[model samples]
Target: MDCDSKTFTYIWEVNLDEFDRVSNLYSPPFSSWNGSVEEPWQLQFYPHGKMSIASSCLALFIVHRKLHHVEMDYTLMLINQKDENETLSVDKHSTFENSEDGFGPGPCIDDDRLDSPPSEGIYDPDRGFLVDGKIKIGVRIPTDPIPIKRKVDNMVSFTWDLSLDRYKAVPNEEDLLSPKFQTINNGEKNTWQIQVYPNGVVPELEGFLSLFLVHRGKDAITTQFEISLVNQDPTKSYRYTMEDTFSHDLNGWGEREVIGRRYLTNNTGFVFGDNVRFEVRIPLDDVSINKLEKEQAIVPFVWEVPLADMTSPTGEYLLSPKFMTWNSDESDTWQIQLFPNGIKSEKKQFVAAYLVHRGVKKVDTSFSLFISNQNEENTETVTMENVKFKYDLHGWGANAMVKRSDLEDPEKGFLFDGKKIKIGVQLATDHIPLKKTDSVMVPYTWEVKVEDLKLGTGKYLLSPNITTWNGQNKETWQVQLYPNGLSTEDNKQVSLFIAHRGDNEVTSRWSVSVVNKDPKKTESRTGTNLFGYDLQGWGSRTFIQGSKLRDESEGFIFDGKVKIGVELPSDNITLSIDNECPVIKEAPACEKCPAVVDSPVTKATPAGNPYDSPRPSPAGNPYGSPRPSPAPINASLHNLYRELKLKTPDGSEFSINHIMSFESIEKLISNLMRLSGSSSNYQPSISSYKHID
Candidate 1:
């Protein structure tokens, strides 16, 4: 049977009575060919089961009768003679060397199940596998050569003896190499040799023996072999087995510490007559020199597009000519996508660029994109390391490469001849694993100048968002300045905070500083906290007093501008998702600048002393009209309050008698009305309070 060309099946029927009479039986030999080699095979059976499974189960095996090596995938089945559909089967892929008679699933079927009733098992006298006193067995096998690029090689062993006395005289720097030997694999000739280092090549193993298998061929090869130090009693030999790839850059792979030099020299079994015999064996048919080689060469691709072509009104993007990372066309193809105007929400703000894979194969690559500037040193470049490009995610890039404005700015010199832009991509053709390091403390600083700081509206002044990196993760952060303080501060102080605007929560140690003319006076506040969507901003609400900050002598204000600096130590920062973040209210908008507002009386007055009357502001009040003083406290209720302090719902406190603002008096009256209803003894008429217009 030329089974290598197609699927082959054979059926053998045996009489159970005869099978039981003979302890062991073999079917007639059948001829099968794999490639050009002819192999004779037979089916072996043990009716009462094999040695270990005797009388408990049946044993079946496919036996090879010739001394040939072949790898095959086969299926063995015990047919239910009564139903056919109810069969017991086992499938396996195995390598067979005629040195061993055969391979099989020992104790193929349980005797109890094989002889059970038809309803409960596969065998029964009238309606199961044992019908008519016979059982049918079948085998299906594909005799084709193993599906590999290279032909399988038979087990081959080579032995070489090293003279320990001679090696002891050799210098540690020298290697003892066995004579080169040739082998043929898949019709290709190759050379290989063994190298033994008396003193290990690496420092850690200097006192040990090092053994390696080196491929002398210029091409790459993958091999599976065993290296053993032959002992006087062969069974006691010390052996090491491994599979590895050998290439031009790495032509050998083995253990640097095979055995301690002293131990090997003292063992009589290993060192016989001052010589140690080392044997190298390719132990399986699949061990061969694979011919397919990996291409590590990198190729550069450049594309120049006219600025007008990218900015044209017709299309959102333009694709560059396709190119590959290798010289051959079979290599993965890629193209550069130039979004003259960016993508999605980033349109018109940034000049986006991406590397698009044009091939079906997934590629692991390290690629860099470059945007050329007139000054070669100032060219903008972005690199993505250890990235993968596949069907699901075929492209990746920065939406904000160089800002569109910056690219078009004549002074920036990004445009060549005021008409074209040059973009280049360098791709690595092969993948190399990257080594990881421990967390490192990286520091970053950002500073911005606020012009007309007091004139800015909204709840706070926001600095431009800056992007920062911690390892492979990136985040956007912005500095927020509340010149008038938060609501709780009551416009008496300036507040400074940093907000994380990224989707992920991060923990970082950060500091915000208000620059002063005198270095010694620079006011800075530091804190470590986890910032996220729920608690977006963190800092001091009383960063600096409004009076001191605005005082000309304090030097906090320079040229009507304030310089704010923020520093972040990213050593401990890590990103994570908070699936259950709570909703937090945003800060209220600033009604007016706190610097111009009159600071409300926050201190308590001496007992029995009259409160200070209101004074008009020279600059005029921004909050409607000036406020009148409050009425005297009711005489009947005077004993109930000595140093009266009224608290608001938001937790701000004020002295009732000294309250000058219209807003504060209204809150006091409201509290009084609510208190009067709750307690009869504290009742006070509305006439006791005065409101200012």
Candidate 2:
């Protein structure tokens, strides 16, 4: 290979910002050639410090080998150098411009001690200035040295937006001498150190590189180093205690390293200092290298801060290596940004009381809607009264008086449906009520039915605070049975009897039962009305005090006669008896009535029997005045009329007859006679009767 013949050539040049701005702009070349093409092309510089040079022919030849066209770009930067020390003058437009005002280098560099500008120097690129090689500029050749295989005419000399050439690296080799960082704990100094290293074979390249370190959890603590040196400088270092907060920048250098300590205010026992590290190399000062591959470093060493170490007033929290894990299942590490425990709240409704009717107007029921915890083991019922309308309502009496009337019977309304009322609960002992954020409402359906109304339309919503009364008073009725001097196979077959008129036969049957002296029970049966009055049976007859007891035996019959009359303006009554007792006439006069007669006497006032006639009394009364009849038949008759049973849909028996014992018949009839007078206020539709058994 003719090393002298292979001159430095200009490869493609692009703006650093433009390279980043248009990364996916042009498509990759369709093909590249390895045949007859030199690898590892050379780079050169002009004598002037502002301009640089490279092998334009070599770049063109390789590009022509693979591509049909090529373009050139360049950058004009103020470069200063003294011996090997060089500084690029950036933002130097002020130096390039004539000061309109009296001041020169306007705000070029401030008086701040930390921001002083570097010392100025000069270089002439035309004086054999070389870049990584000897650039034989202005060399004569048999063939054109600057390749003409492609258009180089419209190429810019250099502009505000400039691009610099790139020397493509030889194939089959990686840029192994990449800048990288490693953290080291120097136990001798009891201090943490960050070391920069060149990983590949050519780690000693002369260029620029930067080392950056940021406090992982604490943004305040950070540091950086920008080295324009050839390789890592072990002497250049940064240190901080656990109490301080910081961050920094990397100037320019290749293969750099960075490390920072756990920031502290007063370094007490500061161990395992907290920090993250990153390093990158700068191959060129042009915008392309400054951008496209510039700062090409992994954002590695994210401090895996442990959640357990997250505490208040944190001075130093060294994360355990074993505790490093991702925030989510897929992510490698949790982001350190502040995350909020998202708190949310919602409103829940509760009802308190229902409106009840008084005559016509609605009044608040004294009853309170009771809420009992479903988990009764842990909680109890809570009763609330005076539940007014929600505060949002303007008026005071709105909820106090008004309730949504049930649709079924708006006339007599009901409020809430029967469910939905729930009690709020708190854990017992140290138990805290579930926070609003921690709890949720459980949906429930409520239903209500009103008694006096038709079904299907009377339902309403029952809020947690409101409930309906479920219990009610039971409807009741009663009946009484009498043994009526009759016997069945067991004992006396009590006669089935009804006294109260409105009582249903079925309900009355359940109310009363007949038991003999032995207290054993017996069933009642239906019977006929013997006297065609209150008492009804073949063996027992019913009669008023004034009505004659009639005989029923067929052959041995007796014709009886009796007359009853009430005294004027009083309940006193007199009875005149004229009986035809044939048996008494033929029985030898009955020997002074045998004291208390036991034998079967004539059931009637027999004809022509002198003993059967009422004799004149010295007391002036055969029957007592209706002495405020304890068993007033007329009052019962009135009750019977009012209490008369209306027929129910289902078949059941009922009666309107006034019921009493035979012994009370006299008093009952007299009371009835008094009640029938003009002064009597008891006016019943049913005729009064003296019940006899």
In terms of TM-score, the best-performing candidate is 1
Please list the residue runs of candidate 1 whose C-alpha ends up more than 4 Å from where it truly belongs after superposition.
1-298, 313-315, 327-329, 359-362, 375-377, 391-393, 429-693
Candidate 2, residues 108-180: lDDT per residue as tens digits?
A: 1132121111211121233212232222111111112321233322211110100000001111112212222
Residue-pair clashes per candidate: 0, 55
Candidate 1 residue-wise lDDT at 451: 43
* TM-score of every prediction relative to native: 0.27, 0.12
How far residue 202's Cα lies from its native spot in candidate 1, in Å, is 44
Model 2 Cα RMSD, 1 decimal = 47.6
